[model samples]
Target: MIGDSNRKMQQIPPLKSIQAFEQVARFGNVAKAAEQLNLTPSAVSHQIANLEALIGRALFVREARGMSLTPAGEQYQREISGILQSLALATERAGSAVGFDCLRLHAAPSFGLLWLLPRLDHFRSCHPEIQINLSCSYETLHFGRHQIDVDIRHGYPDWPSLEVRTIRHERATVLASPSLLERIPVSQPSDLLGQNLILSEAALVQWPQWFAQQGVALPQAPFALGFDRSYMSLEAARHGFGFALESSLLSQDYVKRGDLVPVFPAELSTPVSAHHLVFPRGHAEMSRVRHFLEWVQGQLGHVFNY
Candidate 1:
């Protein structure tokens, strides 16, 4: 590349000349190439003329209306076009590697608002380089038309060919405000018989399923409160309205602040593999995806006691 006489004879053309030649060959007009390259038409034509002189071959056939590529120019264009595209792609990737990387994330509504959003400050503070685009919706796990890099789902998804890791394992137990417990004392699971039970209508694991797992025959009495979303049910339980069976992981901040307390013993608590981080297989291999996955794993790897 530096000193060999044979290599010196094969000197590479100036990048600008090659750029102008490619644009003109594709557009078949000096003015369009000049506009695209943000250079004067005369400048573009000068670059092309210089390139033709250096190559010892006329690259374009001059015409009254517009130019057309010669046989040599057609061959050169075919070769150089792919190289230019590759160069552009490489430049974009290099820029992203430095700091401009963005991660597109989608999460379930309640988990996004009540759990993930609360802890994003810590993640951002550490990795200021990575930008996160967070979206939340109740209808998740379907990547159909959305361009999501990662999905924060709840429960064991049977989605084949997807990389699913359970980020947070939780203890699903009775959660109630201190005032509510003081009003109706519950020493055993059977004591919840006639008590106000706040139910999450769309929850995967509901009170009926909890009782079925506990081998407790539930009464046919109507629930005291019903909500389709967990946040609302949790909020209602925090107001001393009724007992809400919720995951300890999602209600961690509330438990830490003593807004809600576990009403049942640890033995009665059901282990749920909840709060999964799902993505297409091998997606975590990317630096941006890996950063998020590693951050989440590090944050939730420890057990939070009730």
Candidate 2:
């Protein structure tokens, strides 16, 4: 019994030493393993020496050409490789099951606030088991860092190494506070010449574009107040600060509440922009990602026309 206990103690290598030895064995070169594991070659060699001492055997036979594993070392390497591979596989499977591994979603801040937030409850209701992390930025994502799984972009479809799906077409119209419209008489697009304009930096060109489509010359009297986000710009319009060109889908809630009113009738509409769902190329087959894309499409479809 005492002999068996002593032997068991000798068989266990120090944790760090075991890890270093595993890297060396897997890479089949001490220098390469050191680089891969972010350790010095000397440190790797020291760990291997300690591991050899613990096992009471020469694991590798040093030669003029390169080091080679001994008969015993080959056997140990096979066993250790299987154990490590199993551990890695188990961790990956567990992470996928819990959905806590990582799933990154990138979206424009205004759109996320206006459209996505309202419908997120339905997604959470359906995918209660999955954990979702969101990244809100105005700029495009760098997928090289593996930081994003999906991106919702507003523009013409052009992204490298991505599968694009058009979610909705952008249709914008002038909206103003009910109080502002009540105080001032506004019966046509030309009536906006007297009112203040709240311009969003993102859509600074939208009003001009829409006006050109209507064949109405740009107004030159009242200056426009500019804001960074559409939601804030809309808020300014809602507070009677100024009139803003807002997407119908985003302003639907306020319009329904009678807080804001559309400036022009539907017949005077023009093509503004388009929203798209972008995913990494070749990863479109992922089940969870597909589920999210489909859910967004269904929700946005119900809210926006096309």
lDDT of each: 0.80, 0.72
Candidate 2: list runs displaced more than 4 Å. Answer: 1-102, 144-146, 302-306
Candidate 1: tens digits of C-alpha lDDT, residues 127-196: 8987888998866633322556788887567644466777546778789999998889888878899889
Q: Report the poorest 10 consecutive residues by lDDT, candidate 1.
A: 81-90
TM per prediction: 0.66, 0.65
**What is the per-residue lDDT of model 2 for residues 61-130, given as tens digits with 9 covering 90 to 100?**
8776567788888777645543433344346557675545344678888877887877777887888766
- Model 1 clash pairs? none
